[model samples]
Target: FFWGFLAGFLEIVPYVGTTIGGILPVFYMLMVSDTLWQPLAVIGLYILVQQIEGNIISPNIMGPSIKINPMFIILGLFVGGIVWGISGMILALPILAVSKEIFRSFDATEPLSYLMENGLARKKDVFLERFDHEKHRILRLFFEKREEGE
Candidate 1:
């Protein structure tokens, strides 16, 4: 009951959603249970609840709210795990969600909008611009050499 209740509470979080919440109860049982059979039963219950949540509850409740691709989630978790360990991994989803929202808001269609879009687009533009400038410099050098020879 406690595990289920906590799972309900953790459902409030965005992407990580119920997964971390579901794991907690089983881990607690593993640590605290006196009898082998009881811990196994508790673990079994957690697995059952997880299946139900994954199939029925999560689809209905969280749905597109956390509809980011699994690859991105893995990337976030990997970076978060590297930086902040388990807590970082746990918090990564919300952080990524907020960042994505910010990026979307910045993607307006204007010069100012271009400036505002905090993303690789702006960076790529800058790089490309710089490359063009360098190419122009090289062309100028070639022309100067030709003129000198003439």
Candidate 2:
């Protein structure tokens, strides 16, 4: 009952909650059980459940509603946790959603909004394209300088 309740409560947290919820029971099993197989079984079950939740369930359910890239969600969680601990993690998604909207509202920041979005249909390699353009410009200047010297 206690493990179930704990796991349910932690499920409110994004990304790492299910993991921490599973760890507690596994630790308890490790200490109390006489046989090693029991604890190992607990670990395997938790791993399977977590994999299902993370990959299949989450992407299907939360992916559309949240509309942020999985990469950005993970990054937000890390930054939020680092800056404000547990509270930060809890608030991260809403904050990101709001910020993405704010970015979308302005024409100048629309590109940032696109980067944060889950959509991949119109994905732009902004950084690489800019870097490649710069590289060609620099090489042209370098050759121009060499020709002038000759």
Q: Whose TM-score is greatest here? A: 2
The lowest-lDDT stretch of 10 consecutive residues in candidate 1 is: 107-116
- Model 1 clashing residue pairs (backbone): none
Those runs of model 2 whose alpha carbons end farther than 4 Å from true positions after fitting are 13-20, 69-93, 107-112, 120-150
The residue pairs found clashing in candidate 2 are none
Model 2, range 54-142, lDDT digits (tens) per residue?
A: 79997899778879987899999999999999989989899999999998786456556767887545555753353344333434544
User: Distance (Å) between predicted and true CA of 27, model 2?
Assistant: 3.8
lDDT, model 2, position 17 = 80
lDDT of 1 at 4: 76
Give the C-alpha lDDT of model 1.
0.65
In model 1, the Cα lDDT at residue 36 comes to: 76
For each candidate, what TM-score against the reference? 0.45, 0.55
Candidate 1 positional error at 47, Å? 2.5
| RMSD vs true structure, all candidates | 11.0, 10.1
